[model samples]
Every structure is written in C-alpha cells, then in structure tokens.
Target: MSRKRLLPALALLAFVAGCGANAAADDSAKLSLDAPLPTAVPDGAKIVVGDPATEVALKLSGQYDKVSKYVQFANLSGGPQTTEAFRAHALDLGSVAEIPPIHATWTGLHVKIVASKFRQDPLNHPIYKLGVAPGVSVKTFGDLRGKKIAYSPGQAQGALILKVLKKAGLTKDDVKLVELPSTGDVYAQALAGKQVDVAPIGGVQIKRYLAKYGKDGASTIDHGLRDDAGHLYGPVESLEDPAKAAAIRAYVAAWGVAQEWIDKHPKEWIEGYYVKNQGLSAADGQWLVDNAGHPDIPADWSDAIQRQQETIELLAQETGNKVIEAKDLYDLRFQTVAADAIKGGAK
Candidate 1:
C-alpha cells in the first residue's frame, strides 16, 4: 500500500475509536443517589405525576403555573395504580403512603421517596379509625381477636391492621382476616353489610358509617397508632435522568408550598378540593378540614426512615417477604429540598 493511503486509513480508525469511547461514556452516565441533585430543568424536560390531590392543591394555591411548564399532573393515586403506572413508565411521580415503595421494592421495581409529610398532631388527627360492623361488639383492640378484620396486603391500611394486631398482642391466627380491597368505600361497605367485624376507615367514612348504622350499633374507635405517613415517590430511572430529576426537585418544592397553603387557607381548600373537586358536601369538606390538623414536613428524614425500617420489619415478619433497609428507599440528596423551599417561599 502507498504511504499516503495507509496514513489516511490509520487516521480514520483512530477517529472511529475516539467516537466509540465517547458513546460508551454517554451510555454509562447514570445518576448517583449520593451525588447532589441537578438544579435546573433543561428545556423540554417533562415529568408525568400521578398525584391528583397535589395537582388540585397546586392549582387552588396558584402555584400550578410555576411548575406547569415542566410538570404534567395525571388523575392517579394509591399504591396499586401508582405501581402499575411506574411499571408501564407512564408515571414519573406518585403520591402514596410509606407502604407502596416497600411493596414496589419487594415486587422488583426500584423506587425512591423524594418528599415526606405527616400530621402535625398525628395522634389527635390519626388517618384512620377502626370501624366496627353493625351488631359487632369491638370496643377495643382486644375485641379484634376473634373478629374478622378487613385486610389489604399491599396498601397502608393493611399495614395499619398489622400494627394494630401487634399492639393488641394478637397474631393473624387469632383473628379472621378478610382480604378485601380498601379502595373507595369498600371498607365502609364491608362494615355496613357486616361482612367484616372491624376495618380501618378514614376521612368522611367515619362520620357517615355511624350516621347510617348507629341504630344498628355501628361504631368507630381510635386505634391509638401513628399512621400519618404521606410521601411523593418516583421510579429510580426517572430520578436518574438529569432533566427529570431537576423537574422533580422543583415539583417537590411546589408541593411543599401547596401543603402549607392548604393548612393556612382551610376554607378555600375545602371549597376547591373537597366540595368542588371531590364532589363532597360543604359539611363533609369542613369536617375533613377540622380533622386534618396540620402539615408537618421535616427537613431531616432520619426519624421517618427509622419508622419505615420498623414497618419494614413488621411487614417482613407478617408477609414472609425479605426485609430491606429503609435508608436505601430514600434519596437523601432531597432530604431538605422541600422544607427549604417552604421556608424560602420559593413558589
């Protein structure tokens, strides 16, 4: 071969090798959970969130426009639907209790919690109370020993039932666990029809259950456990994307601000969220407001993580599932993002 021809061929090979190295680098560029989160949402970055309550809160609080540029809210919530959405890659964020993330991990879906909220006075404003079926005599947790308690294994309500049983010193063998879906008014309906002797019910269900079945001796009693665990979580893949991560950080900040707005302006929240959006009566809305206490967003998630660890242990024991470290379920890089945003009034 001629020297000139050989030199050009060698140069072309060198250029191809360089291009291959750059492509490899790009392919390996995964986000580190320990690294600091990105600070800006790149142009055209978008996140699909399945958190209807937050969507309404943001709009009513007038903070929707601030995040609407990069955020799209979907009418989705709860563990099952959110997990399904995550599996289909249709949802970037979801609002759920502490259970969904744990269950998702068990089912082989990697996820992380970006924001956490609890009731200010969690005991006084417990998320659910034990609804006793008509003609069932369950005045205390001890009474639950022989009663058929409604249970939903993957949801928060199911975990709460387990916590209650542990508190009562009763094992699953001691009580009849009627596995039921706790969506909508199923628990309430179970109580009304006497299908289950006891089930955990929250919000307006507590008031309506008694009003309709008081004559038949239906009642609700405080379970005396702290069950107010609210969180915004997302798939690890979504959080690893630089643009989506930045957008999530911003949405979390806006979410924290919207929580504060709802706490401060109960009337408007009741009207906009409960009465108008949820199709509940004004009295029902007011009742929810009266019962909701206040929002407590913590800058530090150590205590929350520890509590989650305990829950994981309990669930593992009951369901015979592998126990996981709660810390791994959280992305500590976002530990203080929402709290700082609320304090700084960013939205």
Candidate 2:
C-alpha cells in the first residue's frame, strides 16, 4: 500500500482509460510501451523493486518488458519485513504505505516518490465487507465497540479502519485489536474452532468461506469499511540523494513503456491480462477490471505533484502525524522524462 495524489490529467485519463493503474499484466507485443518519454532511456537504466514479495510481482517481466529495467528485486514480503529491509539498507526502491514510512523516515529511511500509484476508487465504493463468525452478534461498527476484532494492525486496511473508527467516535481502545500476521488464507487458524469472533476478511477469503461453510456465505458478517478511498501504491527508495534520483529516472523510463502499452492496446487489456492468470476466472477478473480500473495516462509531473500534496494532507489528518510537504515526498524530474517519452515517442 503506497500513497499518491490524483493529477487532473490522471482524472481525465481515468475517464478515458476507464481502468485503474496496476490492473493486469500486459500480454501482447503490440504494446508500444514507450510513447511518453522525457528522453531516450540511458543504456544502463536499471531499477530494483522490493515490493510486497509477491511471486507474481517478482515474475512481472514475463508479462511486460518495460519491467525488465527492474532486473534486480528483493522481496521484503511485507509488514515489519519491508521496514526492516529498508532500515538494513537492502533496497533502493520499494512501495509502501503511510504509517510504515512515517516511522521509517525517522530511522534514516529517506523515501523519494517516483510516480502516482493505484488507489481504490473512493467514489465507486469497492466491495469491502465486515465478516463475523457463527455466534458473534455484531451488526454495525458501533455494535463491536467492545468486541475483539482481528486485522493486519497498523498497515493498509488496518490503518484505514483506525481512521474510520476515530471518525465514528470510537478509538482502538474501544475494541480489542488483534493484529493478524497478514491478509491471506492462513487466517483460517484464527477462526478454526477458536473464539475468533471477528476478522478483516476479503473477497479471496470470503469466497473460500462461502464454499466451505454452506455455499450461501455467513449471514452475520457484513460490510466493515465503506468509504473506499486512499492513496494506494507507489515506488519509493531509501537511498543517498544521488542514488534516489537515479532510481526515479529508471522507474519513469519503465513506466513510459507500461503506459504506452496500455494506451495503444486499450481494447484488449482486460481480456489479455486478466485472462492470462490461472487463478482468476476470466469473467470475474474482467468485472474487477471494468469496475475498478482507469488507464488514461498522466500528462506531467506537475499533475502528480498536486496529487501528492492532496494525499499528504488526507494521510496526515487520518494518521494524526506530521504532513510531509509535496516537495519533500516527490520528485518530478523523472516524470518529466516519462512525459517526454509519451509525447515524443520513447527514445
């Protein structure tokens, strides 16, 4: 979970592309991948990605060549894992969320913003629901003020829930906050014959629950977080000033390839990228793409800069932390390179 601001052109691009960033891996060669370039990529533009440690991400080059620039990657896997990696000086660039970096920044992990990343549409209101076990008599957020809830505390959705609770006139102290290790299937251990009355289950988990329980889904569990909006993913690195600037250049160069491919093959994207994955049903994946994505490209770094400012304000208020100035969080010189590639055709 990274943070980003919405550029006006990005908003416009959303309207035009009608698909969100980070939707699916491109699977065609027709992808131009280098339309909006600021300059010709240097002969040695390479980047390192230490993201959520997903095997899919580690293997992204198979889906698109633009990502080849990221020839080296380190998987921090996530949570304190990524934070530790950053602190140990194992990574140059990684995408992270607000709270972790806020803490990391104090520990000498200086983060530099690369570009605007993906965010769930606040307006669209994604399908985030609250789930409860068999005997837990909870109906609304207010009902569980004193009940114990399980989530990946202090990150992504966990942070969002903290903000939501505060706004709802409740605090983390109001309920028992059990920090689940991560957000995957192993969560079953919590609910397996244990008094795990609550958990932050998602679509992946929900489907499994329904199939195993009664094929009808539990009736007690309902929607947890409703106001679906936040700055999502981005590329950031803990590097010396000189090295950070170098990584931004490489990412911008690669993003140029990704965006052009999306722009050029607008029609085939959902079908090609979504259908390629074995785990995702083509139909369901297509629906996810249609409902949540917008692929229209950004016109300039200025637009992303404005987005960074807006996101910083929202995040600061939400987290009760000091707001980082836009200039402090992001650098646009790399994006200038991307914009140039888009307009002049990739060099």
Compared with the true structure, all predictions reach lDDT values of: 0.86, 0.47
lDDT of 1 by residue, 180-205 (tens): 99877899999898899999999898
Q: Which stretches of candidate 2 lie over 4 Å from their true place?
A: 1-45, 51-70, 75-79, 106-108, 125-128, 188-195, 214-244, 256-284, 287-291, 295-327, 332-347
How does model 1 fare in lDDT? 0.86
TM-score of every candidate:
0.92, 0.62
User: Which model scores highest in TM-score?
Assistant: 1
Name the runs in model 1 displaced over 4 angstroms.
Answer: 1-27
Model 2, 86-160: lDDT tens digits are 444344455554445444553455555554433334335343445566556667777778777666644554655
Candidate maximizing lDDT: 1
lDDT of 2 at 23: 22
Span of ten consecutive residues with least summed lDDT in model 2: 20-29
